[model samples]
Target: MQSMTGFGRAEHADDGLIARVEIATVNRKQADIHFSLPRELTALEADLRKLVLRFISRGRANISIHLERVSGCDDSFSVDPDRARALETAFNKISDLIGRPVALEASDFIKAPGVLTFSNSVWDVNEAEKAIHPALETSLKNLVQMRKAEGADLKTDFLKRLNTLETYSSVIGKATSNVVERQRELLHNRLREAEIEIDLNDERLLKEIALFADRCDISEETTRLASHINRFREYLDSSEPVGRSLDFLCQEINREFNTIGSKANDAGIGQSVVGAKTELEKIREQVQNIE
Candidate 1:
């Protein structure tokens, strides 16, 4: 089992850029990615998306990247005569207006267009691909490790709840046996409280007890809940991502517990059903982390 929430950060030394990437994931029903990268790296988006999908099955992921490529590191820039002339004229006019002498220097010209340059290889598909692998691999591996650790904790908590559920199910079973006798005792108490002579062989009493017992009998729900628990644990043992399966089983368990709670009139049975429901709710929440 693996959790869908994790965070990872990686940095790689590119030709002139130290490429940094950070990934954070949160649980979702489907795999969705949000990316932030430099303009020069846009061409590599598809490949990065594929890589992310390979590692994650269900999560909403945010990927952020920072690139620090040295300016004018590759090829020398050429001056644009028109841009330099315009800047030079503006500088001279500004100096004249201020009644001051301003030096027309290379530093002033550096602000002109095309003064700084970029490598032709900056947009190279191959270069981008090459730089991608290292950072991506590092980030993915760390993300997987973090998710695994989180899943281990979730598994421990889930197993404890499962044990609680098992104990509660046993209590409910034992409580179920005396329900018929309990109803009879309740009927006697009610009649005495009303100070009425009750007929032991009353047809209405017989029909009502049978009806009540039929309504309160949670054998069907108990059987189904046990079967669902078995399947739930079985899915957890498998290698495949079982979030959906676990979610489905949680719904089944919740439904059965709800029925048991409604059908049971005995205080002990009701309390046990409530315990089972509480554990089932915890199971449901833990399932959100599974992937």
Candidate 2:
């Protein structure tokens, strides 16, 4: 199991160029990725998305890549002599027209647009891959590591909640074990209190008790609920993505709990059902974060 929430970052420096990659993921039903890359590296988005698919099957992933030259590296920068010369000439002409000589400083032209430009090292697909692959791989590995660790914690929590549900299930079973006999005794006590004398062995009274027992029978529901719990444990041990499957099982489990609550018709059993439902709800919320 793996969680869908994690963060990772890595950087690779090569030949005066540095490539940094950051990836963050959150819960999502499908594999959805958004990329923020320099314009020169935009063409590599498709390949990057494919690479992410290999690491995760479901989540919303955000990937950002930043490329820069070493702080003191000036080799990648070049002056456009043609543009600089044109600018100098234009400035000189303006100075002569104003009848005053104006001195041109190198800093003045350096700040001009296009006067000095750094070469875009990752302008090609091959160069972009060379610059980014190492950082991207490292970041992805870090992300998976974090996700796995969180998943372990989630599994532990889920197991504890499952134990709670099992305990509640046992409580409900015990509460309803002799539900019919208990109801019959209560009915008899009520008749005596009302000063109504009636034959205890009357066929009509016996038939009513039998009907009540049949109506409140929940053997099938409890059996199914137990089976669903077992299946849920199996899913937790699965290596593949089980978020959707576990979500579906949550619904099945809740349905069984509902049936048991209604059919058992005992206050103690109903309270146990409510507690089990609360635990199941927590599990369902955690399931949404699984991948």
Candidate 2, residue 101: how far the Cα is off, in Å:
24
lDDT of 1 by residue, 1-291 (tens): 789999998988778656678999999999989888767678788888989888888989999877655565656445567777788798899899999988898777765555434444245556656666689778988998999888888888887888888788788878877897789778878988999787866888778888988988989988997898888777767767899999988998888888888888888888888878877887888798888
- Number of backbone clashes in candidate 1: 0
- 99-183, model 2: which lDDT tens digit per residue? 9988889888877777877675434557567768888988999999999999989999999999899899888877877898998
Candidate 1 lDDT (Cα, whole model)? 0.81
- Please give the lDDT score at residue 169 for candidate 1: 78
lDDT of 2 at 255: 97
For all predicted structures, in order, the TM-scores are 0.78, 0.82
Pairing residues by index, what is the TM-score of model 1? 0.78
Runs of candidate 1 with Cα error greater than 4 angstroms are: 11-18, 68-123, 192-204
Query: Which residue segments of model 2 deviate by more than 4 Å?
Result: 14-16, 70-116, 120-122, 194-196
